[model samples]
Target: MRANVDFEDLHFERRPYDPQVAYAQAKTANSLFSVEATRRWQDHGIVTNTVNPGGVATGLQRNFTTAQKESLDAAEAAGVFTYKSIEQGAATTLVAAVAPEFAHTGGHYLDDGREAYPVPDDASLADHPHGVKRWALERAGALRLWEVSTALLTA
Candidate 1:
């Protein structure tokens, strides 16, 4: 994706993954893309990073039935979790955009103005070396879906 950019007009934001499993994969992909792009364009000073705003009460929860939401709320109330308001939801994103600490932290995940932890040892990815390489492979698969259409139009 970085290989075909018009930097002067570059502006893009990815959607958040809803399902936890998909979200994890998306997060991983986001990390890899940022790392690979930064390495591929370090001279240009391009930066990329991931931001997780903990939990937010958003319309995305519409997919969850009332009972589910209630259960979630109950769980949160029990001190097992917490959710953020919309303003709080945007905090990490804001920090990512302007925080001095992030000026040099690339290919990392930030949450609530600080670096967040990654998922526990998942054997599927724990054994992999060169995170960016894995990301490139996954992104290559994603690119394949659009390659033909892009070629046809550009040609």
Candidate 2:
């Protein structure tokens, strides 16, 4: 599924819910938030980053739709990804939170304990399993997301 920031229907209130699409959009929004937060708060010494804690079998999966479960199973069978243990999943997040190399930097997508390489926005997840999509960190989209989110909150 393509990760998109649909400015008009961000909340999906007017859209049909496809689990993959909604998840992708939500993840993109999260990445965009980190990008915009870093840009706006760097001067104040705030740091923010996105972390991909790759597929731990947590309670979060309890909500997975049948299609989502089948998709994950298929991807695993195809060697695209493997589920990590909870501890392993948290390792990447810990790297982002406390690693010395990440202390002063922000807005990077970290996976498997390091900054993930950037892939084109159109890159297939099967081809770049550990990569971050370019659009997820687009500065202009981040800025616009920040503005739109602010307006929503204040409205």
Candidate 3:
């Protein structure tokens, strides 16, 4: 985000403080980080997974103004984003955490209770597609990001 760069080339070390792109980078990093955890913890019978729980209208948006809330409502109405209740939004993670089907399905991203496809969607509140980006599953990038995050945290 600090650096205007290609989507595939997001660098964990170079990630800046730009709220917009930085948020996306952080989301990508979380998915890749989950992949790393799945790799290192699988033999221990540990499972690590990630989920994009879609959009949920809840107290989380308590700060949004009327206009902003309306914007989200409009988007959901237009099928640009899927709005769910707090309980409904937690469904995917709840399944990933306890569902037997995911016991061996580590290192994957889920959308609506299934493996997410790679569908790049418009981000202008125009269209919201539920899919993980290809970069989110990059093992090498995950490892690198793990190192960077560890070093930063430790320092």
Looking at candidate 3, the ten consecutive residues that score lowest on lDDT are 1-10
lDDT (Cα, tens digit) per residue for candidate 1, span 2-108: 22222122223354323443444555555555655555566777777777776788776777667667877897888766788889989889999999877865766
Arrange candidates by lDDT, highest first: which order? 2, 3, 1
Q: What is the C-alpha local distance difference test score of candidate 1?
A: 0.56
TM-scores for candidates 1 onward, in order = 0.59, 0.92, 0.72
Taking all chains together, the TM-score of candidate 3 against the true structure is 0.72
Candidate 1: regions farther than 4 A off: 1-18, 65-71, 122-155
Best by lDDT: 2
Write candidate 2's Cα lDDT for 1-155 as tens digits: 67778898877889886666777788889899999999889889998999988888877667778878998899889888799998999999998989998788799989888898899878886787789889999999999999999998999
Displacement of the residue 68 alpha carbon in candidate 3, Å: 6.5
lDDT of 3: 0.70
Q: Each model's number of backbone clashes? A: 0, 0, 0
Which candidate do you rate higher for TM-score, 1 or 3? 3
